[model samples]
Target: MPDSVLYSAELPAFDRATGQLSLAAHHLISAPLSFLDLSPPGSTLLFDQPPAHPYQQPVLVDDQPRRKRRRTALPSADASPADFAALRDKRDRQTTTDRESDEHHAGIALDLRAALEAVQQGWAGRARDEGWVGARDDARVQWRLREAQDERPELDLVGLAAAQERQTVETPVRLEPPRAHLSAAQLFNRLVLNDSSSSSTTVDVGIETSRVEPAPPALAALLFPPRSGFLMSDLSTWSAPSSGIAALGHAKGGWDVVVIDPPWPNASASRSSSYETFDAYDLWNLDLPALLGDKPALVAVWLTNRVKFRRLVKDKLFASWRIKGTAEWWWVKVAADTGEPVWPLDATHRRCYEGLLVGHYIPPGTKNVALPTIPQGKVFLSTPVGHSRKPVILDLLRPYLPSPERAPNVLELFARMTLAGPRAPSIDPLPPPEEGKAGTPPRCGFYLAVGNEAVKFNVLEREGGAVRGWIRQSGLEKAEAAACVPEGQDVERM
Candidate 1:
């Protein structure tokens, strides 16, 4: 979180003219990290090392023709050569292939090749010249090996009673959410208001909202560990008859922008076991449309490159949700050290990049409206952060907000960390509707929202030894003042 270095060094620089933002993923993730020591004693800090290759496409051992083996790991005792032949027959008759999915997804990348190329050569070039880092520290491996020694081995037999006591759990950082029976809505409100709640801890961005009065100093951006976001929250409460979601529809107003990163089921993500995945059908329970009421919205969703997800969003999800497809943005991941794509752009299987599908949500019966166009094929290039983590995107999305003059209500569903900056103002005692002030609750409902997975990543730091949303002492406020304040102005001149 070298906030001072973020904009000044020009790595995370955004050329307002060209609509590109480039910076190392760690710079964004490091914003709140004041001081942290996660490695076991005598271990090297993993953050100092370069990020390794994102993923290497596995070589298919079965691709080459193989001779029959005397004893193969058979599926069952009754397995026979006929069953093997049947499998080959089924494969021969299958019309669909993973290659087809690759081609369809590659089509998307090909369409945006020029745009992404331009950004890479231009803005990313400028960032590299200005010294933006390509990668940063990650200690996942070191942490895993060291943490194991801290455990009491089951091998301690009765005869081994003379053995030394097990290692004390000195670093008690938790990698999982604490069990709590608190209401998700209440927990969210406590976070927004910076109030203490059952979550026990809060991660606040010490920045002022777009408030009319002199703003309070931004709160300490600490740690958040609640598990209410989409990953593992008991979702029944979100849609129950007596739940706050019903109130969200009427009491709260509509959001300006909604960003959702649903934990869609995937073979890779499932195998990684990073967090819980949800069935596609579970999304309906979120009542996402209800959060929008009548407001026109800029919807940004993070999607995997799989064709199933792309089709789900384009063919079925959008139609049922009344969200009109508008544009697509690709978050191209490159290496921090070499500043190149982690995997080849032409590589088909195990592709390195992810998609951020941008769309518009307008309630039924709304007409004669004007909305800002989302730049098609926008490219956001940064090194990959941890699993399922994305760079901070509030600034890039600012242009398309329903109310672009200032901040608008934004909801980040399935958010890993509470976004690390100024949020839309929340006035508990709303201004009278007749007054027509900005704080007046909208007729629709809560415009912007985030899921309960807020603290999921807080635990990631504990388990993997990689910090998320922590920053260096160069505070964002300092960055803003240095960038905006006059060079010769005295402290009180303004």
Candidate 2:
């Protein structure tokens, strides 16, 4: 993302099967803009449950009132003996496995803090001028602030869920609709790699839509939106290659590094309705080996804090996909305001850090490609942005690649950054196109966002003169409890 000029432009995903492109998946989102807002909300405790130890230290939040804990209903004094026994049994029913996992993770956080502090001590002086790349002391801190207004889109679309899971059907089966018109491979191929080292380039793929969608007879808004919802004429009008995006040629080759980020199932994400989450099988459908070009490439997966989620990737997914596992790294979220972890380091039920699993994906019969051995237990500190979006760590992982001269071709399996750019004060808005015509691309400053729903986060307005905000973020917003698993009972980090 270095030396790139990100512009506010529409990202059009293409389907080679029908040779059509659509923006429906990345269209106007009706969800709360607060989660996507540039301003970080007042930090609150993610877990309300008491810490594992009886003598746990009190946590005092900064610039915010302490939240009163919700009281559990107690058994009345007149209740039967049987009722009292049941209540006591339920209280002590936490499984042995759960207790062990919680204890294990609590220890892991302590070690991670120690390791991060060591790295910070070494890089503290140099990091002051450039920004907090790794870690820092009391010199400077970056706080997220939000602008008060709305940036509404004049366009919208609806599409079918496409997935038919085995879950039991209700009286009327409800399928969560999909966002893209193209398959993953087709979309990945169509992604434009714009390196603005010499000159800044922006390719706007603007299309026209009716002022208000004429509702179809099938209840398209309430039900699965039909595939026939889009017209061929609605696709972006593409000119010659060099005229729009020049360096798009490299997206074809087998990627030297493939980063797989799935929408892992999360309890918190479900309750919040921020975005949709999918099962692990949905991720398995993507043939991992096929994506990596015939070379000894590196593969990394962003993991949630849960042991089950970690095991799914490290145990089954990696081995089955032929990505020989190597090492693991932890991305600890630091609060820009406090220069401390967003969550308490020793909080029993929540973790400030998430997991990253890496490996050298050298398949059988491939030789002479000497990929570097990834060091184990690595940690990086960076402030969180926009609701637990994973920070850009490709630069950190680049060192593990076999060769530095040949900048590795990186492919993100699941990307959700906004493709739209920030409009500068001097720029004028392009006239909206007629209902059937493709419009001119808007002129604006931008962030380099590529992948699915890349425009979903566009609603966020920028903060002026803020120091050390994250540059690039890919995917993964998992929120399980600190450790242990029973599924469907975890909290999230905001």
Pick the TM-score winner. Answer: 1
Q: Which runs of model 1 end up more than 4 angstroms from their true locations?
A: 1-100, 123-232, 239-241, 245-253, 420-452, 458-494
lDDT, candidate 2, at 470: 26
TM-score for candidate 1, residues paired by index: 0.56
What are the per-residue Cα lDDT tens digits for candidate 2 across 322-391?
7764677777665433335666676645677778899988766776666676656666665554454665
Give the poorly placed runs of model 2, Cα more than 4 Å off: 1-92, 95-100, 103-107, 119-253, 367-369, 418-451, 455-494
Pairs in clash, predicted candidate 2 = 6-446, 8-420, 8-421, 25-179, 254-293, 349-482, 417-454, 418-454, 419-454
Worst 10 residues of 2 by lDDT: 226-235
Give the distance in Å from residue 173's predicted Cα in candidate 2 to where it truly belongs: 36
Prediction 2 TM-score vs. true: 0.52
lDDT of 1 by residue, 63-106 (tens): 96444342323346687888788767755774565546756665
Reference-based lDDT, residue 413, model 1: 71
Q: lDDT of each structure?
A: 0.46, 0.41
